[model samples]
Target: MLKNLEPYLEKTIFNSRWILAPFYLGLILGIVLLFIKFIQKTIMMFNTVFSASVSDVIVNILVLVDLSLVASLLLIIIFSGYEIFVSKIDTGDHVDRPSWMGKVDFSGLKLKVIGAIVAISAIDLLKSFMDIPNELSNGEADKLMWKVIIHMTFVVSGLLFAIMDKVVGDTKKH
Candidate 1:
């Protein structure tokens, strides 16, 4: 009786992976929302182009870049996470299929996520710097300081993640 129950239990547990399908669908919705915001920002930028200063234009462009990066990061997560944890995407002989779609494992996903985060953080910091006032109040100064601190933290964390991955990879090789 115990031997018969073991196979049934294992099969049930394996089939439970389908529970994650809804989560990937939700991420697809998130990408659609990002697209809407991207379009809105583009329209606003176009309306203000003649009146905007170079710095303002640059900041607007950075905002668009930031959105694009986030959307791209979401796409990577959706594809890689689904493949790693749920199921392989069946893109049979598709010309447009991303080369990296099936290649990124969980470890690679982690690095890509962190790298995108560091980049996004850096862009935010740069935008804040560009908007700095000639004279900052205590609150403003503190806020800017905290932004710098947070950005540095992300940078350090990304480096640590890379180092740890490298160490693990080297260990596996040996």
Candidate 2:
């Protein structure tokens, strides 16, 4: 009978969270890929450090910063997403464990993601600005304008996300 199968169905549904385990594993792989790129960039930066102009050095540094932010963002997502949706990470009192590992909930995760995105966008914008030549070609000018607009969009979106989260939190209190 349908009623007899209710428990079985419920248990099956509960066990389905394991389906997301592969996704978290994939994200860990992504972090490894980022690390490889980071090392390559570091070598390139070192090679250029002696002869590159100040602006060139700054731009290279910005590239490294951008990669680092992205990698860190991936870590945040991997840790928080796994905890929030999949399962608890059993980091038993390890000295190097991140303080925020188990503390961030879904709402906090959203804010962190948006904040990282805005930061990455800002870094990209700065890099673009630094690379601008004195003579602004029409195409290059348009591209720069588009980058500014895109960066502004990300900034505004992050602000809106924070405001909405705060509003929802306040509503729950009342």
Candidate 3:
């Protein structure tokens, strides 16, 4: 009877593998978009400096940082998602998987992504404050203060995750 049930269980597991196909396809699509964003940001950066507007130059620098953050996120998803849902990445004899592809666990990647996002948001808020008219009576200072608080929260969370990871690693060694 156990032998008879074996084939049915194997077949179910095999069929379930196809469910991940669509998700992998979406990841491929995301990679393409990230590449496009990289190119666009490069062009904008060059153009901004040529136009000689100090504000535009600063904005373009922020955009470059934003693009880099997005690229990091794309890599985390593509590598880890494949490893988790598809197969172990064949790193071969490579000491480190392409320098950037270091052994980042899921929690570590999440913390990094959250931290990057928070930094980007803070930069955007700063840009907005710079754009505000000097004569306006609106409380721009208060808004900037709130953004700083939110950014600090993200920083603290990321630090906590890093410390937790270190503790877990040490426990495993012992």
Candidate 4:
């Protein structure tokens, strides 16, 4: 009787990877939220294009791009995390498939994530600089400097990740 129960328990534990299914589903829902936000921002852009300052319009566009990059990052995490940690994604005969869908190993995913973050940070820094006249008038130099510092931190972190990946990749070749 114990021997029979052993296989049953093992199978159940093996199948327990399904527990992560809901978390991935939740990420999908979050993706939808991002899409909605993007659309909303786009609509606002159209509404304000004529009346908004040039800098304001540019800043709005940058916000949209930032949202898009974040959504893309989440997509990579969702698809890769599911395939790596959970179950295989059996998308047979699916045309319009992404090139990097199945090929992004964990290290590649980290690099892509870091790269996107650096891009986002650059956008933010540019946006802040675009507002420098206002920042100076408002006595916000300290805050502006902080933003620049934070952006540099992200840049350094991305560089470190790339360097480490290169070191590891080179060591593996031998």
Give the TM-score of each candidate. Answer: 0.95, 0.94, 0.67, 0.84
- By lDDT, the candidates rank as 1, 2, 4, 3
Give the alpha carbon lDDT tens digit for every residue of 1-174 in model 2.
999999999999988988998998898899899889989989998998999999999998999899999999999999999989888999899999999998999989999999999999999999999999989999999999999999999989989999998889889664
Residue 142 lDDT, candidate 1, scale 0-100: 99
What would the per-residue lDDT of candidate 3 be over residues 120-144, giving only the tens digit for each residue?
7777776766666666555766776
Better of 1 and 2 by TM-score: 1
Please list all clashing residue pairs in model 4, or write none if there are none: none
Query: Where does candidate 4 stray beyond 4 Å?
Result: 1-14, 134-139, 172-174
The regions of model 3 sitting more than 4 angstroms off are: 1-18, 41-52, 91-102, 118-143, 172-174
Error of 3 at 166 (Å): 2.8
lDDT of each: 0.94, 0.93, 0.72, 0.86
RMSD of every prediction: 1.4, 1.4, 4.0, 3.0
Candidate 1: stretches off by over 4 Å: none
Among all candidates shown, the one with the greatest lDDT:
1
Clashing pairs in 3: none
Question: How would you encode candidate 1's per-residue C-alpha lDDT over 1-174 as one tens digit per residue?
Answer: 899899999999988988998998999999999899999999999999999999999999999999999999989999999999889999998999999989999999999999999999999999999999899999999999999999999999999999999999989564
TM-score of 3: 0.67
